[model samples]
Target: MLFSFSLPFFLSLFSAAQQGPAAAPARVQPSAKIEWRPDRPLTWEDFRSRPATDQLAALTSSSIDAKVGCVDYVFSAQVRAVFVPTESWVRDPKRATPQLLRHEQVHFDLTEVHARLLRQKLSLVKLDCEKLQPAFNNITKMAFLTWQREEARYDQETNHGLNLPRQQAWEQQTQQRLQQLEAFALK
Candidate 1:
């Protein structure tokens, strides 16, 4: 069970953040950010309030805490999705149902989708110590922009999960997208 940082209610622009700045720009321990798993869909119980974000509904961001490194000309890095229970509260516990959960999940799903794309792109990249950070930053920047754009499109197309038909459509679209990027899912 986990609450998340993906907010459709508010549209914030994320660049190579990118990683979220809503929370303080503290250094995140790799262990702190949970990696998104194909088997897991967020549940309401996961939305605990202790580490709350400033009253937002959902937030989806990635921590490529892994800096690009090359040993013997081989490049490697670690990238994962980190879900923090910020900006989550059941408006009506009774009404805070799967319908809404699905919407929130989409927010995180969108983030994971970008993460996959990042992984795919990063996999092919060759790194040299001198050029590593800039190249990595470029990948991060592109992924982050795509993430923000997709978030907006999701909210507009689905009406923040208010329109069931549109919501369903988004679900199908995202699921298909996930399938297309399955090869890049983190191990």
Candidate 2:
């Protein structure tokens, strides 16, 4: 995602003082990111590398950015998903078990869901450059709020994917929702 996140960095942003016009914030470190893959589910092996010894667990994040243009009466926006491994990381390898991997996988899957939703909406509605930014912003805001709420609910409902029955429910729900939005799935 064009958005940057790391437990420490995100947390630090909260603690650090606001920057004034004269104070440009320090540069953020680059994170190693992977694109969301439909064929491959995450595995424990994927959590091997830890960028920093931050006092927190992993955080999965996604975002959408689109380019809009028009020709005569036709309007089009190409929406895409951005996943960043830079901000996403494992706090402790030992704690990264199969269940944890599944939890992380769900986060990525939710991202794909938003991407598909955006695609479906774009296909049905036309927005020229004049109306592009606001339209894209509105959609992105909705997707982001949904992603945040669902992620929290997933953790709460499943106890961070620790509860077997609850975790399965979230998994099935995510799968079903993905299927419902299959028409706009990524290529």
Q: For model 2, which pairs clash? A: 1-82, 1-83, 5-87, 31-86, 33-85
Q: Of the candidates shown, which would achieve the greatest TM-score relative to the real structure?
A: 1
Q: By lDDT, who's the top model here?
A: 1
Query: Residue 187 deviation, candidate 1, in Å?
Result: 2.5
Query: In candidate 1, how many Å is residue 83 off?
Result: 1.6
The TM-score between candidate 1 and the true structure equals 0.72
lDDT score of model 1?
Answer: 0.58
Poorly placed runs, candidate 1 (over 4 Å): 1-32, 50-67, 86-88
State how far residue 147 of model 2 sits from its true place (Å).
2.4
For model 2, residues 66-162, the per-residue Cα lDDT tens digits are 5555667457656666555455555544545555656677777776777677678778766555676676667666666765676677777886666
lDDT of 1 by residue, 69-185 (tens): 677766776666546544343333333445666777777777777777877887877656567766666677777767777788887777677678998988888889989999987
